[model samples]
Target: MNTRSGLFAVAVGALTALGLACGGAESVDELPPEPPENEVNFPALVQGVVNGWTINTSEEFPPIGCGAGSLINQMRCVGGNCDDVGAYCASAGATFSDTYWTSYFSEEGTNYRTCSAGWWMTGLVCRGAHCDDISIQCTQVTNRGTGSCRWADRQFSEEFPNTYSLPSGWYARGLACTGGLCDNLRVYECQLL
Candidate 1:
């Protein structure tokens, strides 16, 4: 190989070794920008680690709740029928972590559930009736300051650039869906960060 080609190969190898290659690992630029510090809700979700909970895939939702030390962050429907509800648990005071898709093939067929640490389940972006192509939007939370927030019943939608954003004085907490197909994306709201 030419000298220039050899040097290019060495550079590529070095980048791959350091997890900087195209698909090796995400670099800083690939990561979502950090949300404003004062913003109680965030859309910067990453893939979260599984906490080893047996996800229910039945027609009814299993009694899945956040652990004692963890807070309810992301809430959405999962399981084969989408009849089951699940929530992501985050350690208290955690700003935001990552989310992962847990898949299961039950009697109803293939299904998935989204989980994350310290995330505020925003909403889902689906393609059609099957809703298989699910994109979850979430907002993370933390208890850095001394203030309380409440869940509001008001609804909002596709407002922000990528996902939903709340109006002034409102924030997102989690999401809720109804019916077997989860055709609707309901935004859970909160006020006063």
Candidate 2:
């Protein structure tokens, strides 16, 4: 071969020897690629809560007698199906005619209940308050629709973050949730106040 061909052959030989000396490792291009980020598979939430209320009560005054109901509770439910709660409140002298039913949504299910202690405003001392600033966040997989996923008097829930004093109270009227977030909470003060 000519001088150039000889040189080319020597260079090729040197490259092969260098590769062997370097453990013959493949370049980075041969490695597997990295997985993507923020890839959500099932239903989930990055922040905030489901469609519901917080029901805040100050340290001074909190709920005493609490009544819960829904579409399918242990006994009573929504829309005039509160015989259980009604009996409990009546036994405690809390008039059902003057009370208000509070409904809130959650990841588990929708909550339906009556607040009499601080909310009924039945001439009794304000036992507590219902603030809609509940900060509950979560993500899960379910067969629920993308909307509010809320049913009527069919889903019953107890409660959480027990920040109250009494269980039952007198009664009141006209209180509801405006569907707001934690920061933009809705406070239903005692009607007497």
Candidate 3:
């Protein structure tokens, strides 16, 4: 068949499958087959000693994303803080990761004999709205310490308290967002490990 016919066939198949799954009046045979069970216990979620966690964020505009909202979450984290945040958000329990790192930069390294610590991070990440809604929220899902992230848009140029600095002996991490409305991922919580 030509391209149009091929496309039509694919479209019909997808709709048929969707209809069958979504309360559609379809026979049992129309449903997709399930895979055979493979009983295997997955590894437990546990935290361990590491350098620290790092949460990378995106700077998308308009209908911002990343936050655990209506849209698919875009934020992911690494390190101990990642585990804690995941648990906190899921409330299932604390999970752990081993991804710690540090960064040093600039003239400060020469003048003060020290460079900027990678742990120091700041940004007003807004999703739906802008900086006007200066509300930063970090919710704990599980005792194990997993975190769910969120944020908004950017309006004012002034620096809000949208920043975080892990303690001297701590390794914290969190998600980030963009837009200029309400920061999607603001580090509202930090833990010492």
Candidate 4:
């Protein structure tokens, strides 16, 4: 055969030997399938109504995340002899994150921090504090909220202690103190998403 025809014969022979000639290639059905286009990646809810807040008297508890549905949006303090810290949670449907310190002004004032719309009051942290000082520990889902939610008119203290369970959707969200010890507490609830 001519040189060009000889090369073609060798090429065809190699392809035939390797089972890659013409229809010898793999069919569409025989090929591996492609991966999924849109995978579901979402955080799970901590099931049941359970309390996640704790009182750590010695040192600062690291900033914890919402292990479930919403995201911790803000940490705020209401003034007493010491400040009480409250957290605002927002829905995971949107991007939101922030941390700030609010000054303790007076005993008569009950500073409040509220969750935004479509967000739930998940839980809170109550650590020992000096004047205007807050040591936070954002932990678990201590209680489940229900019905229409709103802030309570009074707070927990030495006289009006948190002796009873939170009313309906109400939750203990903040803690005020004296002499670096937790004494007073605050409550509120929001529509959980």
> In terms of lDDT, which candidate is strongest?
1
What's the TM for model 1? 0.29
Q: If both were scored by TM-score, which would come out higher, candidate 1 or candidate 2?
A: 1
Candidates by TM-score, descending order: 4, 1, 3, 2
Ranking by lDDT: 1, 4, 3, 2
Relative to the true structure, candidate 2 reaches a TM of 0.16
lDDT of 3 at 140: 23
Model 3: how far is 79 from its true place, Å?
A: 29
Model 1 RMSD, rounded to 1 decimal? 16.8
Off by over 4 Å in 1: 1-118, 122-165
lDDT of 3 by residue, 1-193 (tens): 8886676557546644643211111223222222111321212222221222223321222112122211111123232222111112211122322211111111111100100111111111221212222111222222232222112222111244223433332222322323323222333223322
TM-score of each: 0.29, 0.16, 0.20, 0.34
lDDT of 2 by residue, 84-186 (tens): 1110122222222222212222112221122322222111111112222111111111221121111121222123211112212212211112222111111
Superposed by TM-score, candidate 2 places the C-alpha of residue 152 at a distance from the truth, in angstroms, of: 29
Question: What is the C-alpha local distance difference test score of candidate 3?
Answer: 0.23
lDDT of 1 by residue, 53-87 (tens): 22322232222333332444444444343433344
Task: Score candidate 3 by TM-score against the native.
Answer: 0.20
| Pairs in steric clash, model 1 | 46-98, 46-99, 47-99, 48-98, 48-99, 120-139
